[model samples]
Target chain A: MLRIGLFVVTVIGALVAAAPLIAIAGSNPLSAYRALLQGSLGSRRGLAETLIAATPLLTCGLAVAVSFQGGLFNIGVEGQLVIGGLIAGAIGAEVSLPAGIHVVVAILGAALGGALWALVPALLKAFRGVHEVITTIMLNYVAFSVSTYLVSPGGPLVSKTQPSATEKVKATAHLARIWQPTRLHLGVVVAIGLCAACWFFLYRTTAGYRLRMVGANPTAAQFNGINVRGVVVRTMCLSGALAGCAGAIEVLGLHGRYFDSFSPGYGFDSIAVALLGMMNPLGVAAAAAFFGMLRAGSVLLQAKAKVSKDMVTVISGLVVAFVAARVVLERRLESSASRRDRRRRDG
Target chain B: MADVFSINLVVSGIYLSMPLILAAFGGLLSERSGVINMALEGEMLFGAFSAVAFTWWLGSPWLGLLAALMTGALIGAIHAWLSVTLRANQIVAATAINLIASGLTAALIETVWGKPGVSPSVRKFGIVHIPLAGHLPFLGRIVERLTVLDWAGLLLAPIVWIVLFRTSFGLRLRSCGEGPEAAASVGVAVISVRYRAVILSGMLAAAGGAYLSLAQVGVFQRNITGGRGYLALAAMIFGKWRPVPVLGACLLFGLADAFQFRAQVAGVNLPHDLLLALPYLVALVALATFVGRASAPAAIGKHFIKD
Candidate 1:
């Protein structure tokens, strides 16, 4: 009950905080919210778009949640996602295989690519005690540079006709569309399955138990005969693999090619999703869906209310801030309630 | 190579390093006081946006600089409240700050300027002629062309070194960071000192933002700091959290930046995107080699809980 109440309070606090900003942007807060609801949930197409947008977010949120569970901050999810997309895109365009196998190979290739990208930071963190935060963030810029170089005009992967993009993924490699006329794809199902699998792996597996032990108390875990360093490296690689899948899904399902600057900070947003979800797999799914609604609805919010789509970013940021402060907020509420109870009894 | 060694290149390098220097000092102050200030990027962004907005409103660059400092202080207070008072996870809180700054600044750009991505150019600080510097050959060319903020950024290092190492307050602050419980036992106001250090850190970072908008670029673009704040954090680590060494680190980054620009102008056979990644690569190398847990404040990132 307390968890539910805290979650509700966090959501409300974020919205309340964002209302004034909406007003300042010359829109009535109520109308802006109405537009957001209408655009994201009022139509079938909107709902599908919400799910489509939620796909990558869910996967990336799982990535973040896993790392958090292992006591690692994998801020390089953005770069990992990009590397995954690049690798998947290259495989999808160049490799020839049977239909199902082609897509599978492309995605697995992406996971490998992301894992390789994360290996440097993971090893550095495990052996040298270098903080993963700075290294991962630095690598993000490197990833951008690499992607841009590959797709730049006259560059290696540049498409003949399209600017700053690789050739489209082969038809056999494409993630199948599920809902007709709504642009919903099979990637959403894959994402949900992945979420369930992550939940199972985290709760029911020995490796997961070991990872959690390291996260909870590395010294204690070491004393208990766990290889803490090895766990850290493996946890980071697993997290990077999930992030890579997010990128692969985006390319194979949504964009159909590797485009330069494709993501609008989905990887960064996943950090907030993971936090707000309390670093749980199922909670992350719900949080990602909520953010997806905001993203899907923002188009109409912009068109109907003249509020910029960037308002969604502001709202997400506010939600994260509120979530970060949730422990204090909960304590304040409990203390105030107790005080009120005492006053009533005395009276 | 010859062009890279020119006086003009050195001046540009100094100019490029100014924001990094200021922000690195901000990180230094906060970390030295036991607070992990990963929000330097966010604070700098807030400073950049507010400087542009206030300058556009009031039609004066000086006021813009003032506004940036105030905005930065406000953000610092918020961060301090979350990380210090509430005892929230410092990294998580800082992440929120960064997101808020990025989002709010981007949204407000549309609201205030009727556009997105970039703000209108405002009145910016012009060159300041140092007394008798124009008469000197190489030094004159370098010193005479700096803006007021550039001069401030250059002078702040020595001033910070003195304030950190020479004063009683500095000793108290260092004690608080090293051992807050011990400091409290000795009658030092640990909480208040941390609050002041974090707030001052914010002001300095905001001044860096002010330099970006009011001095360097003369306009605020969306996400204009572009990971320079992270770069500043890297520099702080590379310098082992010392003021003079941090200043040197920033200069090294600045020189890398200047070299990138010169390489492009001289038609060096490097891709522009790779060139853009040079400073970050340098930072990564620096961190991997120089930083370790031993160099950080003993009690950094630990929230104080009074008994």
Candidate 2:
């Protein structure tokens, strides 16, 4: 109940903060918000669009959450996703196979690409004692640069005819559409399935238990004979694979091609989503959907309300800040309460 | 002509190094005080935006620099409050600040200036010439062309080294980073010291951002800092949290940036993106190869608990 209350408060606080900005932009906050709702949920098409946007975010959220569970901060999700998507795109355009096989191959390619991208940071953290945060962040720029080069005019992945993007993926590689009016595809179902799979992997499996044990206390885990180093590297690889799938899904489901700078910070946004959802799969799904709605609605907010799409970024940032602040506040309260209880007993 | 070109390259490199040294110095102050300031990027961005915005409003680059410092310090206080007082995850708190700054600055730019892409150009600091020395042969050419801001920024390294190593306040700050419990036992207030250090750090970083906007670009773009804050953090690590070494690292990065720009001007056939990626790639390589085993403050990311 407290969690629900906090969530409501955060949402309200973010909206309130955004209200003035909307007003400054010469739009009525209430009407603009109403338009946002209408844009994201008023029609079946709008709902489908929301689902489409949420799909990759859910996968990326899972990626970050899984790594967080392993006590590793994976800031390379953006790079991993980009590399994975590029591999998927290349495979989709070049390979010829049956629909099922083609899709599987492309997805696998994406997973491989992401894993390769994540390998450097994982090794550095596990063996070399390097911090994952900075390395991962650095890799993000490297991935961006490499991907851009590959898709640019002289790059190998660039289409002969279209200079800015890779060639179209084969029809067989495309995720089949579930909703006719919208871009909703099998990617959503796959994303959900992956979320369920992640939940199972984290909760039910012995390896998962070991990974969590390491995260909880690395020294204790080591004393218990757990191979802490192996777990760290493996956990990163698994997380990277999930992020890779997010990239592949985007290419296979919606764009059907890979272009430079396709994502507008979806990978980074997933970190907040994971935190907001308390690192739970179901919670991540809900959080991703909420953000997805805001993103989907931002277009309408821009079009009808004359508000800039950047306003959504401000709102999301506010929500993230508020959520983090609440967690910190709650912890302080708990500590203080315990302290008070001890004092009373001692007295 | 090549001599002039070389001089231009060196001067531009120094110009690029100015913001980095300031921001990295800020990182150093916070880290030395046991607070991991991952929000340097956000602080710099806010500083960059505020510097240009204030400069436009006040029509004075000096006042704009002051505004940037205050804004940076204010954001730093928020970060210190979240990380130190609330014991929030420092990384998460910093990330929040980055997002908030990115969004809020962009929104403000759009709402106030009516343009989402870039802000209006503002008055900027002028170039300086070391009067007598500027007339000398080799050094004169480069020294005469350096901006006033660049000279001050370069001088900051030695100043920070002195403050961090020579002062009693610096001792307390270092003690907090090394062992807060020990610091607290010795009649030192760990929390307040950290707060002050972080806020001061933010102000210094804002000076870096102001240099970017008012001294370098003369206008604020959405991401004017452009990961230079992170580069500064990398430099901090590369310097092993010391002022002098960090200055050298910043200079190296600046030189890479200067080379990229010069190459672009020379119409080099390399992909533009590749050229842009050079500095980041160099930092990554440096981090992995040379700085992998670098030592950090003992209690850097640890939350202090009053037991």
Candidate 3:
């Protein structure tokens, strides 16, 4: 019941956040809501598309959430994801195997790629005391370049002259849609399973407890002999792995090739999603889906409502701005509550 | 050939070094005075965009520079008001400023120019010939053919060094950054000192942004800073919070950038990403091998309030 109440509040918040999009769409606010609901969840096709869109975001949000839970901001998830995609794409270009084994390699390679990208920043933070936020941001740019170099036209972007992607990752490597003509594929299952796994790890495991304790207070954790530095490194690596998986899924299941600059700032978006979801794996999952719907329906909204496609960014930016401006939010809520209290007292 | 290249490399180093110097110097001032300013990049972006727009409009690069400086100062004052005065979390405030700047700037570009990427190239401030040095030897060869701003930056090095170390006012400012409580106890108005430091940082970062637009690239692009602000932050760290090392770190980054630029020009089929990633990789290497046990100011980021 508590979860349901929180979910409803967040949903309303999302709608309120998307108000600017409504104005841009030139449709009445209520009509925009109806269109969004009908377009994303009202039909089986819409639901599947939303699920597909949610897959990478869900995993990426969890990746960010897990790291933030450990008090380490992981902004390199985009970079990690890109590296993972490159590895997956490279593997995809090589051998032929049973689809299952091929998928396993793709996922594994991606996880490793993300983890490796994160390792540098993790080491610097642990050993040299450099801020991960700064390091991770710089790494993101490097990741962008690395992926572009790997997948450019002369490289993996063009194997032959058809202007198609790196020769279709052996037929076995493809993550075919589970539902025909829908974007839904094997990755959605993985995303949900991983979310469950994260919830259990954070709430039920001893290792997770140590991480939480360390995240809350490193000095106290150190006094208690908990290896704070070790936890920081491990959590960051784990976080990067999940983020890398997001990239891998996008490549293996959706696009089937490593594309240069594929992400539209997923790493930064995940920051807002993780925070809005209160850093709960379940909440992050829900938030990711909510974002997924917005993204999936945005194309339709733009076409039918005559809105510039960029309205979605404005809406997302507003949501992040509102959430981050917690001081302003708290003050508004406080003043409103006090006014009500004054009325009650006088009455 | 490599020597000429190396000389050109060092010249590019000096060129790239100036902006980082400006941004890092700004960051140091804000950080030293107890504010963790992550909005340095945003301040630069604000400067970069304004500089381009002003240059396009007025055709005087100096006017563009002035616009950038003001934009940077405005952002700094906004940050100081929210974080320093209102006691908001400095990181959160800075992040908000960054986001707002990004979205608003892009939106402004779309509305104004109908494009989301780089602005039109303008004739900007660039290499200037020093009157007598061009006629002289090795030192003259290096120093004579430099940008007006390049000379200003080298000029600023000792000026800032003296202001920070030699003067009583500099002592009071450092006191505000190092230990506000100590400074406050001694009757220094810690808040005002910090406010001034941050404002100065914003102004310098803004000027650096203008340098990027009006001098470096001569055009504005979304995210044109491309992690330079963080690079500046890294330099600030590697410099151990001092002016000389700050300049050195910037020069190192500039050298890396110059090499990458030359390598790309040579078209050696070296992955562009490797070149793009060079500065960050060098930063990590520099921090790991070079900087040893650098300690930040004691009261950095802790807001001091007299109860």
- The fraction of correct interface contacts reproduced by each prediction comes to 0.69, 0.55, 0.31
Error of 3 at A39 (Å): 7.1
Residues B97-216, model 3: lDDT tens digits: 675566555545544466656677887896787678777766777886587777777777677789889987789889988888889998998888888888888989888888887787
What digit string (tens of lDDT, one per residue) describes model 2 on residues B258-306? 8878877877778777788888887877777764464788899888877
Better of 1 and 2 by DockQ: 1
TM-score, cand. 2? 0.95
Q: Can you rank all candidates by TM-score, best first? A: 1, 2, 3
Name the best candidate (by TM-score): 1
**DockQ for each numbered candidate:** 0.72, 0.58, 0.32
Off by over 4 Å in 3: A1-50, A153-158, A161-165, A297-321, A327-347, B1-4, B126-129, B267-269
Error of 2 at A135 (Å): 1.2
Q: lDDT for every model? A: 0.90, 0.86, 0.78
Write down the TM-score of every candidate.
0.96, 0.95, 0.88
User: How big is the positional error of residue B307 in model 2, measured in Å on the Cα after superposition?
Assistant: 6.1
Model 3 TM: 0.88
1 or 2: which has the higher TM-score? 1
Pick by DockQ: 1 or 3, better one: 1
Docking class of 3: acceptable
